[model samples]
Target: MGHPMIQLDNLDLKLSLGRLVLNVLYIKSGFFYHSMPEHRHSNGSYELHYIPSGHGRLIATGREFPLSPGSLYMTGPGIDHEQITDPSDPMFEYCIFFEALPSGRNHHERLYGRSGGDSEDIREIARLFLETPFWIGQDSRQLQHVFEKLAWEINTRSIGYRRNITIQLEQIVIGLVRNYTNNQPTLQTAPLKTLDDKRMVLIENNILYNYKHITIRTLADQLGLSVRQTERAVHKQYGMSLREKLLEARLQEAARLLDTTLLTIGEISEQVGYQSSESFTSHFKKWQGLTPSAYRTRTIVPTIQ
Candidate 1:
């Protein structure tokens, strides 16, 4: 049977998106020698381990899941799970770890996140995946792609181009929930363009015409979605938040001007919709780790030589 898509409504996701904050997310893939350490994650994390090849056994709470190619296992925070790898054929596992702020149960919170963090009506929602059992014998290359990009982002110097991996991780967990429930979402009445696809087409056309000043609000209003919703849509479609996407556009424009024209910093800043050169410098530095002048110097120096 095919795996079911996530039912977002059942998870109360619509009510929580505005206040949700991703606290931590990390991905790692490696082969083990003898066994995994006997350890427990913080009571706030949810982890998924997928074995790509080799052999092993996952031991958690007196349960042993035989590890094989395409085997998947999940563990909740503070849940002790161990792995015994075959000495000859060591287990190669892809692991994902994450935590959502204000997602814990009965979290002591303050107003406006002054003390505890964002308001929380349901503390146990994010934790449900922790309590869920391991999913074995599931081959998911989609999940593999998510991890691959996450690993790239975490290891690379592309920090300014923010990417939200948590969203995909949440979807994966929901897919697992669907499997647990054995519920496949009903097919759509008719085939239609997805909201994300439509938005992408619109954004691309706008960018092709005028990328000098594209803001989050512009994209949000065009799609009749709130800023957060629009950002989520962008994340779903491109694996990047709208802010990062727009910044990347602006950065590209700035690069082109710097490489081709002799515009002053103030002029280039205004051309890219910045109110001041200082503001432009700060943002540019954040993305490229260099001021506009410094970048120009570096790029131009190579040409002169």
Candidate 2:
């Protein structure tokens, strides 16, 4: 533990953490000997590709950019992109895909092994995705070192390797953000994101806090966006329809009421925006396969037993 570390240069990217959830999907390195076929990432996650050797061209959003060793670029959710190798020199790169968990704490804590020291580290990692711009061209040997470490950890599959790779990913993000912001590299790129972070956060907060009263018109008006625009943006960014998000919000609230309130099933349904108790019961059954009354009873019986 005595190994000294270099001080990370200070950089700023006005980040806010309403809720930070970063789930790294996979990390891999590849060497391409020929042109890559056009493909799109359909899974709706943030992506990064960094080339440490060779030369190529990256085609994204119908635009082509110079690609060479140490050039880092991004492809956002729902974006179609492709790469062309330099033919003789080909191209070798490291690619990573990360999805932001919408909600869920148990799954995250289970993966990263939060030994009390990793929470702050995890927040720093989340800042990377929140603030990082797409397509950086800086060639940082330091970053390359961290990426290679991840590649090795992933490839070898040692004990606790999952945790190892996760931790290293956080470090790599922190390092890259610090370096990129400080240097202010001239390469221009932005994730093909369709929603504003602040607005999206506000919408999610409003939905969670006021599920019973939130309406598409009121929510859209509050954001100064038309209803159609609001729906489109929500679907684009979250990969779920507005109807789905609202239903989830209502379902989440109904479950909470079932657990914490003595209100009758009908009253609880009304509280969560259902007009008729019967209608609420039907929806609740479909959503949870348990009537509101049954869910409440099930919860209470567990405690009593």
For each candidate, the alpha-carbon lDDT, in order, equals: 0.55, 0.61
* Pairs clashing within candidate 1: 76-130, 104-123, 105-123
lDDT of 1: 0.55
lDDT of 1 by residue, 1-305 (tens): 11111111111122132233334344557777757534444333456677767887776654566787777666654355667788888877776554444433333331123334433422333333333533344654446555555555444526452334445555555555444344322221111112333354465445434556667788788878899887776665445665665666676567657755799988988987788889889999998898889998893322110
Error of 1 at 118 (Å): 14
- Per-residue lDDT over 77-131 for candidate 2, one digit per residue giving the tens place of the 0 to 100 score: 5455557788788778777655554333553443244444547655544544544
**Which sections of candidate 1 miss by over 4 Å?**
1-22, 103-127, 130-141, 155-161, 164-176, 183-305
Which candidate comes out best when scored by lDDT? 2
Question: How high a TM-score does candidate 1 get?
Answer: 0.41
